[model samples]
Target: MPTKSNNTGGRGGARAGAGRKKSAVKEKSENGNPGGRPLEVLDIPEMEGVEMPKPHDFLSAEQRDGSELQAADIYRETWEWLKRIGCSQKVSSQLLERYAMASARWIQCEEMTSKLGFLSKHPTTQKPIPSPFINIGINYMNQAVRLWNEIFQIVKENCNTEYSDEAPQNDVMERLLRARKGN
Candidate 1:
């Protein structure tokens, strides 16, 4: 007598609709807050009649030229932004100084790379090698990103106001902050 064979036709895999059912989870918005529980909005107190400190107080005299000067400008602009958003009290002057310097250095390195090109000559072998400015720029950019992230962490957790950019379209720092927030 012939035995009855399975109808799978030698197929060993799972059939259609055979896996576990997916849970009906609600999608999160940009803030990553689900609608079930109430989100705790932090109220950062605004500073009243405070004077913005000069960059010379934080940066040494020797570090106040070219890109460093630009860094100083960046620091001032960021301070004003923080003040406007009511989170200036949360971040320290030292942190802003560091962030500015790193950003400036990154830009300086990128400029150098663009001007000098990516290839360089070795000291002894005289072979074409990747420009040192490329790695230096990347390192500076990483530092700037870390510092910016730290600043934004405070702002995101303790500030209820939306991050608004009223600066011109050419504002590099503002653009960078917005990009970081999107991430």
Candidate 2:
């Protein structure tokens, strides 16, 4: 008697129909979702005829002392923000004073730099000449910039807001709370 042979090779047995079948009809939901839950539409009520309060007027009267003029708008806005952040009157005044001083120094540095550029020229060659005052002005400008940055940082820290272009989750208060929670 001849025995029956079993040859499971050449695209036979497990290899045949092992992949997914291509469906002729595309499956879809009644809400047009393709294999997910239906979209939700919320019915929000409209708030018509609600009068909003105007922002506080922070610009104060300008003061002029002979040749020097005070920037009332800058001082006013700074004072308003500092007050909103719960800063004391004395601290706010001190910060504003420092800011004004730095701003004045910055203006003076700009003037000095411009004057130096005009004065720094050779008599015959007409070439630009170097002077120590340029460097001094640059140093003063740097100091003023540093003070301005310090003031901004102080305000940002006290106000619990992020001034940089980072992600919202990286806020100072969020980080502090996360650290306190041992997250």
Candidate 3:
């Protein structure tokens, strides 16, 4: 006679896991999803024909268009882009107006400076018509002034001479004169 194990209770239907085998060994529901709703194959909302990225995937660095642009650099670039687009007079006028009123106010300030006749009073403030633009990369331009300062500091620290001991200056009069004389 076979001995009846206390654990099985001599019945295999539920206790011995004959019918409860699946319950004992929990089947991970599709993706171990707790909710009844189906697990999403794609993270983003998929279109009729277009596919979406999976959960593990992400937008590439190139796909990301971030504001690496500085205010001054943007002012320069927008003007350049406007020029490249080669707008008609009506469109140009509209763009310039919109650009002044909305996107940037720098041009408006520049126009005012010229119109106010104070441009001559402040000779240093009067610059040439800002054209012949450079394609300065946004990433580089943001840190331009900061990098320039760092470079200047490096030069000041490293290029020590007798003049280095001289007092701080409003202008480099000596250097300016020498440069003018083609020294």
| Top-scoring candidate (TM-score) | 1
lDDT of 2 at 135: 70
Whole-model lDDT per candidate: 0.68, 0.43, 0.30
Q: Model 2: what TM-score? A: 0.37
Q: What is the TM-score of each candidate against the true structure?
A: 0.64, 0.37, 0.15
Deviation from native of the Cα of residue 6 in model 1, angstroms: 48
Better of 1 and 3 by lDDT: 1
Best by lDDT: 1
lDDT, model 3, position 3:
72
- The residue-by-residue lDDT of candidate 1 on 18-117, one tens digit each, is 6654221222234465555555554556669887777764443345333233577778888889888777887888888898888877766766676688
Model 3: per-residue Cα lDDT over 1-183, one tens digit each: 977767767555644313421211122243465555553332223234322112111111122235121223333343333233221111233232232222122222333344443323325766644321122222223333333333233333222122233221112234233433545
The global Cα lDDT (0 to 1) of model 2 is 0.43
Across 118-149, the per-residue lDDT of candidate 2 in tens digits comes to: 35776789877775556765675576456555
Clashing pairs in 1: none
- What TM value does model 1 have? 0.64
Candidate 2 stretches greater than 4 Å from native: 1-66, 69-77, 81-91, 115-133, 161-183
lDDT value, residue 81 of candidate 2: 52
Instruction: Report the poorest 10 consecutive residues by lDDT, candidate 1.
Output: 21-30
